[model samples]
Target: MSERDADSDDPGDDAEELAWETTGTEIDYTCPGFDVRRDDVVLPNGTETGFHYVEEPQAVVILPLTPDGEVVLIEEWRQAVGRVNRGLPAGSAEPDDDDLDAVARRELAEETGYEAGSLRQLFTIEPANGLLNSVHHFYLARDCEPTAEQDLDFNESIRVSLAEYDDLLSDVLDGEIRDGRTVTGITRYELADRWQ
Candidate 1:
């Protein structure tokens, strides 16, 4: 038997006992930014099934703060949502992107034309682990300032803006800002006691 199977037989190993064994995997569809993958697996109860999820590269989300303690935000058209969405600067890592900090800086510049004097990771999370096999690295960027023109992707339509940090927090608490990544990054930063 495999090591996993052997471990599952241990009486106290609840995690191993509940784990599903992947029998096979297949790509169901492919798109520009992501792919749908289906995995055939055997459940702990001996039932077989297939699970589908989005397969994509890691991403970075930035909460950029200017020297005056304002938060830099972006308003962009999100086709899937069919409306303009306001959020923090974020993007998927490109193939050539080796460092996550560099990716965060690049995305912040590309989306808002801002450069950060210092960048520190806030947290990492899988926003939708059940539906998407994607990870988002959250960052807190300090002393950001406008330094260059936006280098947005061909499909992007974005507008840059700044809001007072307290006001931004209020908006988030008031349900005015609905973007998931933005909400997650903002709340995480706020609760960490490091945003001030």
Candidate 2:
């Protein structure tokens, strides 16, 4: 078994230290979505090096469920990936957004035209801990109902659909659901055993 699977509990006690202290940082490039930054760092053994990473604001992914237990999924064309991505409804948190829950509510409505009767944070994850500076917060949105028309960006092409929870799970397990955040969110939500 792999190291992660081998340890059912805390593994930090036996893990090697690979921590780095950032001495300085600079933004190498910036774009509409994220910025690439270079950091001057001192390694654990006092060796200095440069580390590059992508930085972005925190984002939220909502697993919206209809009253009948169907999951709301989105198929969006992602220019970076050069194909349509199948995943949960997600978006970046706006500067003025009240909090993570508020971001989830807003993104749910804006992307899928659905409003959640009850929303709760399921978990948060860093898709790329080594190379990205962003946290993806996953929310479980229940009793969702159609509310308004999708308010999408000019570059967004999102097709929303409702799928049975089991079907969604099957897709994730069978490799049809490939989005990192989506797979992580589903795994966490199911592991919680709170599906209703």
Best by lDDT: 1
Give lDDT tens digits, candidate 1, residues 1-196.
0112244235674767777889998899997889888889999999999988888888999999999999999999999989999889899997778899999998999899999999999788879877887889999999999996799888999999999988988889999999999888888888885645
lDDT of 2 by residue, 1-196 (tens): 0011224334585454655677888989998878888889899899999988888888999999999999998899988889999889999976577688888998999999999999988777768867787778889999999987799987789999999998999999999988988889888888884645
Judging by TM-score against the true structure, name the best candidate: 1
Over the full model, what C-alpha lDDT does candidate 1 score relative to the true structure? Answer: 0.87
Deviation from truth (RMSD, Å), model 2: 5.5
For all candidates in order, the CA lDDT equals 0.87, 0.84
Which residue ranges in model 2 land beyond 4 Å of their true spot? 1-18
TM-score of each: 0.91, 0.87
